[model samples]
Target chain A: MRLAEAWRVALDALRANRLRSMLTMLGVIIGVAAVVALVAIGTGTKQQIENQVEGLGSNLLLVVPGRIQAGSAPTSSPLTLDDIDAINRVVGDRSRVAVTIASGETVRAGSRTGFASMQGVLETTPTVFVRNLDRGSYLTRTDVSTGRRVAVLGAGLARTLFADRDPIGRQITIGGVRFRVIGVFEPLGQSLGVDRDGEVHVPVTAAQRLLGTERIDGIAIRAPDRDRIGDLSTAVVAALTDRHPDTDFSAVTQEQILGVLGDILGVLTGVLAAIAGISLLVGGVGVSNIMLVSVRERTKEIGLRKAVGARPRDIGLQFLLEAVLLTTTGGILGMLLGGGTALLVDRLSPVPAALTWWSMALAFGVSAAVGIIFGVVPAQRAGRLDPVVALRTE
Target chain B: MTAAIVADDVSRTYQLDGVSVPALRGVSLTVDPGDYVAIVGTSGSGKSTLMHLLGGLDRPTGGTLLIGGRDVSTLSPDEMAALRNTTIGFVFQSFHLLARTTAQDNVGLPLVYRGVGRRERRERAATMLERVGLAHRITHRPNQMSGGEQQRVAIARALVTGPSVLLADEPTGNLDSATGQSVLALLESLVDDGVAVVLVTHDRDVAARARRQIVMKDGLISETR
Candidate 1:
């Protein structure tokens, strides 16, 4: 028989029992939907993390003090400004490298008070850290040299302290010292577990004096190009070790952190996808069960067709087409439902959930394969039915 | 031309729970084109078994059965199916019309298995329904029509493929006496049109309508008149 006729016959049979067909398709729908939704969430989170990592300035390295060993006594030695200068000297021309330091503190403005992070930076901090000002101006070389008491508020901090009012020129107290807000930083959103929009920036000298410390917390260095970041990191470590032999500090390149994070997230995504695949297997078994019942119920119909000169292959093909149609249709409906859910998640939460073409294709391919794999036994049973016995059944 | 149907010492045995029971005991018969033959017997006398074998619905365990001169036992399953499609047609006691399907589509079913295109299949089905005097009821489903009308649709479906012989097992068993007479008259007309007809039944009055009558007793042919 022609394929079109077989398709028509299958359609008629399904339509005759609409409720049963829909019930049989429910398993496939849930299976495909779960796979698509979970995979979309996984891929979306990976992309979000990659974008945040890339948002940090290119060709950058961080230097921080190492913890004391278990048996060793605590050391009061911390990285200082002199260490930054010595690293610059060892890394070649000063123009090709720059460094900034930061410390966490609480700041208050009149009736409003909140915990905030404070950064002690040089004139080139904005360029090296890829920060931009929303209004007013960045600190200059004289601000650090003269120890000026000027500060820049991050966007979130400004909003919390002043509401909708402009924060430039307003006075804010940090660690019990009053300073004028010279500028407000543009919105940067969250990155690397730090809220970039909720920080306060001041000159290194003013921060050192106000916080009662000449020791720096940590240093961020920018290389002239990506290719030179490795060499610059090695040089920074050598210079810091030479300057403070008794102090333990570590310098880490950006790629090392990204590589570790990618590995962890990749495993997490794989586990989630595997869990979703289990539901698809269950759905395939449901399809097989329903197909077997349909074959049993249609035995007389099979006999009638056989008597009318239909070959065994034709009977098998008709049933197989019915099974495939059920699954592929369910798969399409599931995709729509999953895509809608992902869009809703992206809107309602900070985590992004995006559906990709390849994931959709994979879900569809798996559904079709599931249909064929589960459909074969029932179709063969219908084909191998004894016509005489089947006709005698009714 | 060769006979439309030739059965030479054909036998069929059924195994029920591993116990062998013979259904047809080496019965031989020949039917020619344009012949209206009826096989009459009581229940369990193997009349239905012989009809099934003649229609290629089953294979005899011993001896040979041929339809349109093609040996049935030698033909593969696929070839037997093709032979049934081209040479023989069947009408059943239950009228076997698919419920919820229009008469036109039900009549076109045999041609569908023959791979006929959609438009031609419909045209041939319509023509056959017209010949069976059900032209106006082509769009009606089986349940929408009377028992006699449904049987007419089955007859139309049987004749749509233009086969050489028609095998009908109790074709008028479910109809009233008046309706059964009309159906037998239609089959008589078909035999007059040069298509051989084989009718199986237990009703002596029904068998009396045919030109030849064969009687069966305990899986063996007892008489022919």
Candidate 2:
């Protein structure tokens, strides 16, 4: 049969049953669209998290006490000031390092009292810590070396402790011990699971004297040069292992953490995609059923074509083309709809959903495969029809 | 003399509810080229069955059935279709033109299978329409034409391939007397053109015009003249 005539026959069959065609297409549409939308959303959330983490200088590594992996973890370690000093001395000049100790403390100034993260940190913390501040001075090397109990309030902490007052130079009681307020930080949003703009800062020595623990809970570090971050990371690990060889403690890089995060997102995308792939299988079933029904409905037509010299392959081509056309059309529509939905969510909310070109290509290719797979049996049945019996059928 | 269509002891049987029903039993016949042959019988007397077997729509269960010197009963389904397309044309009792296709497209269907070019289809389908006296109904679908017009379109499609033989099952069975005679005149005209024609009919008047006639009864040939 001529290709044109085969298409004409296919189109005629599709047109003959409008409701069935539409219903059949629904399966493919929903299936492809779900795959596109869900994968985009999953990958988008992952991208957003990585962005937020990188904003805090992706080269920055966190050394929290104990071993902890996010989403699934055990409690952090009891890292202390001595450990921080040791790491700093070894990784000195190779990476920027900061030692920090944190305790929940209540600050009182003139009748206002507020809860804050009383972080006793070295002066170098602000340099390697990568913060954006809105107001007064950060701590100086003078403050840490001198153990001067001077404090820098995060933007939120400043708001709470001083309200509308000029907070710098004023003294506030932390755990009832008075300390001079040196500065207030800028409003930094969520980063690395920490609220940067909502904490209070003090000198590391003072925190130990006040908390009566010489131990620090965390240390933040940044490789001095990004190009050598991996080398620097290896060096830091060797140094830390050398310092406390048998303690079972380890050094982690932000890049490694990001890789772990990406893997998690990949699994999430795959799982959601498989769930959506259920719809494609359903769509394939729809194509099979529709083509089968078309064969039955066009029995005489099949007979007539058989009588007229249509090869079995020719008959098969007609049915296969119809299925391919139907599914391909559905795939196109689904891509447009799914991409548009993702765009809409990205624009209207913080969904961060974005459709990639490959996603659309994947949808189309899968839909075509589905059509061929589903179209085969019905096309073969139509091809194998007996002309005489079909013509004589009422 | 060599025959255009010859069946030698051809037998065809069908399985119905597990019982083998013989529809054609050792039926043998011959038709010379350019002869108008009519097959006449009562309903279920195997005349339609004979027409079907001769047309290559069904294979004979036993013996040899030849069209233009080829044993059609031995051909594969696809090969038989090729034979039917190139060697024979068909017109059915019901004017079985596709319901929604224009008369021209219906006529062009055979040409499509024949792999004729677009220009050739246009020229040949139009000429066939003119031959059948339905030139004006070329663009009209089957439902838009009268029974007589529809039959003419069917005849045009059958003849468009220019086969040596035309097998028509009850060519004018659904038409009125005037329309039936006009269709029969068209069939007779094919005989004049030296294209052998086989007509299956219950009407004696329809059968009478054939240059030769065969009668079938109970799956066997009862008479030939």
Candidate 3:
């Protein structure tokens, strides 16, 4: 049969049964919508996790001091200035690698007292890790070298110590030694589950003096060449081993963290996509049911067309196209709904929702395939009907 | 000359509920161009069976059947479909003007199978409808028209294909006397135009209108008068 005529015949038949056709298309629509929505939510949550991880800084690596086993004095071989100096020298291109060292100490400001993480670092430490300083100058390299009593306080520390008062330049006592307030770091919300802007910064020598311990317990490192993270880690580990043979330490790479995160996202996407696939099967079954009903309804028409010289293949194609067109149209609408939903989520939530272009194509392709697959039984039924008996049927 | 239609020693049987009820047995007949032949029979006389075989709607279980100079006794289903489309036109008793389709589109149907362009096919269908005095009803659906009008539309549809022969199986079976006579007159006129016409009917008056009449009984032509 000619293409236009076949299409006309199919459309006329569908129009003859309007309610049935719409009901049939509804299955496809719901299937498509479900697939899109499920995938979008799953992928959106994954993106949120990635951003939360990334907020810790792309290059920053954390190292915690190994504590002495059982009741023994806290590892005397703590991360020291010598170890920090060795790490800095090993990755000497300052543009690429940076380091921060910190220790825990009791700090007293006016009448308030708190156990604060007193970090000994350069001014650039705030910009690299914790960010957005609200008040004063950070402890610079010159301050570390000279053992100045100037301190840079965390937002939380400042709030606790001075309340609403200006505490910059005010003197705070640490371990019975008075230190002048220099700068305040802005509130960087939650790093590794702790509020970052809740700490304090002072010159390395001043921190050692105030604590009466020349020990550093924590160091955060940044490497220059991301691709050479393994080499950088090796260099740091070797340098640390050489300086303090008995001091056990460990080094980690952000690339490894990123990989673990990627694997999680990939698994999540796969699981969500599989769940969405169930809808396609349901949609296909729906098409088959609809097609079967259509065949039964149009029995006389099929016979008439056959009597008028319609080939079996022509009859089959018309029914197949109907199903394909219905499913594909549903897929397109579902994709639009999915995209809009993702955009809405992105707008409403702190997490980002991304709708990749491939996702649209994937959705559409699945829908078309669904139509073809599900429409087969009906097409075959229509094709196989004997015209003589069909015409005689009431 | 090759007969317009020929059935040599034809036979057909139906397997109904696992039992064979023979519809045709060792029947043979020929129709030539411009011959207005009518087959008369009561129910179960196999007149409908003979029509189906002659029109190539069903193949004979035995013997040769030729239509438009081609032996279609062993033709594929698709080949038979093509033969039916191009060589013969059927005028069913019920008018069979497809429900919900415009008269023009129904008439233009053969051209669609023949792959004619849309515009020209519609024009030809219009001309055919006009020939049947139904030019005004070109866009009317079958259900929207009267019995005679619907039969006229059916006639227009059959004539639009310009086939070698026109076969009418009880063409007047569903119409009133006036409508049936008009439809018969239309069929007789096609004979005037040199198109062979074979009509099947039980009506004696309808049979008498044809140039020749064949009486069928028990799956065979009992007499020709």
Candidate 4:
């Protein structure tokens, strides 16, 4: 028989038992939806992490003044500005690397008080960390050279202290000393558990003078290119170790951090996708079970068709087409549902989710395969039925 | 001329729990074109089994059966199905029209298995329905038609493929006498057109409508006239 006629007959039969067909389809719908949505969410989260890491600046390396031990507390020594200069000298060229130091302190403006992470940086801080001001001007060479107490409030800190008003040129008390807010930073949500929007930037000299400590907290170094980050990190470590006999410092490259994060996220997405795949298998089983029942129920109809000269392959093809139609229809509906669900979750929560074309296609392909794979047994039974006995079945 | 159907020493047996129960015991029969034959017997007399074997719906355990001069016993299952498709048509007593399908589509069903295209199938089905005097009810579903009309539709379906023979198993058993008479008249008209007709029934009146009759008892043909 022609495939089109077989499909038409199959569709008619399925329509005859509409409620049963729909109930059978529900399993596949839910399965595809869960798979699509879960996979989209996982992929979206991984993408978001990659973008955030990329935002931390090109070829970035962090130099911290502590020796991390496996089971013991990290032993720390003070990092000085001379160490930053020593690392720059060891790296050979000033344009090849740039550094910024950061510390935490409290700030007050009017009647409001908020805790702020204080960043002591040079004029190159903006370029090295890839930061830009949302308003006013950034720190200048003269401001850092003369130890001027000019500060740039992070987006969140600006919103907290100044509400909706602009904070440029306004004076805020930091570490019991007043500093002028020359700029306000654009919102940079969160990175590595630190709230980027809640930090304030000032010169290293002014910060040391005001906080009564010349000891630096940590230095962020930006290499000229990504390929040079490892070499630059080794140089910084060597320079610091030579200058400080105790060598209580660690230099971490961006590639190392990203590699570890990629491993963890890759495993996480795989586990989630596998869990969703199990549900699809369950749905396939549901299809097989329902198709078996449908074959049994339509035994007489099958006999009639056979008597009318339908070949065994025709009967089998008809049933197989029915199963595929059910699943593909369910797959389409599930894609819409999954896409809508991903959009809803993205809007309703902080967890990121996105629907990509490849995921949709993959889900659809898998559902079609599920239909054919599960349809075999029932279709074979129908194909192998004895026409005489089947006609006598009722 | 080659006979439309020839059954020689045909035998069919049922195996029930490793015990043999013979249904047709070496029964032989021949039917020619334009023949209107009725096989009549009570239940368990194996008339239905004989009809099934004659229609190529079942194979005989022993003996040779031929339809349209082709040896049915030697044909593969696929070839048997093809022979049924192009050479024979079957009408059941229940008027087994698919529920909710229009009469035209129902009549065209056998043609679908013949690989006829949709447009031509529809045209042929429409002409067949017209031939059965159901042109006005072409779009009506089986449930929407009367018992006699449904039987006419089944007849139209059987004739759609232009088969050489028509096999009816208790075709009138589900109809009233008047409807059964009309159905029988349709069968008679096909016989006049030189199509062989085989009717299987226990109803005496239904069997009497045929020009030739065979009576069966105890798995054997008792008489034929």
What DockQ does each prediction reach against the true complex? 0.68, 0.66, 0.58, 0.73
Task: Tell me the deviation in Å of residue A210 in model 3.
Answer: 9.0
Candidate 3 lDDT over residue span A220-289, tens digit each: 6775547766777677777787777777766665656667877877787778777777876787788788
Off by over 4 Å in 2: A68-79, A104-116, A147-187, A192-197, A234-246
Off by over 4 Å in 4: A65-78, A92-103, A136-150, A164-180, A205-214, A244-251, A347-349
Looking at every candidate separately, what fraction of the true A–B Cα contacts under 8 Å does it contain? 0.57, 0.62, 0.51, 0.72
TM-score of candidate 2 relative to the true fold: 0.91
lDDT of 4 by residue, A354-390 (tens): 7888878988899999999999899999998999988
- Residue A252 CA error for candidate 4 (Å)? 3.8
Error of 2 at B63 (Å): 1.0
Model 3 chain A: ten consecutive residues of lowest lDDT: A93-102
Best by lDDT: 4
Highest DockQ against the true fold, candidate: 4
Q: Give the CA lDDT, 0 to 100, for residue B64 in model 3.
A: 85
Q: Write the per-residue lDDT of candidate 2 for residues B1-225, one digit (tens) a residue.
A: 678888999999999999999999999888787989999999988998898888878888898999878888567767887888888889988877888788988898888877787778878999999999988988899988889999999999999998888999998989999999999998999898999999999999888888888998999989987
Question: Chain A of candidate 4: what's the TM-score?
Answer: 0.89
Q: Would you give me the overall lDDT of model 1?
A: 0.86
Across A91-194, the per-residue lDDT of candidate 1 in tens digits comes to: 65554444445667788899988678888878777766678899989888899888899999899999999899888888889887899999999999899778
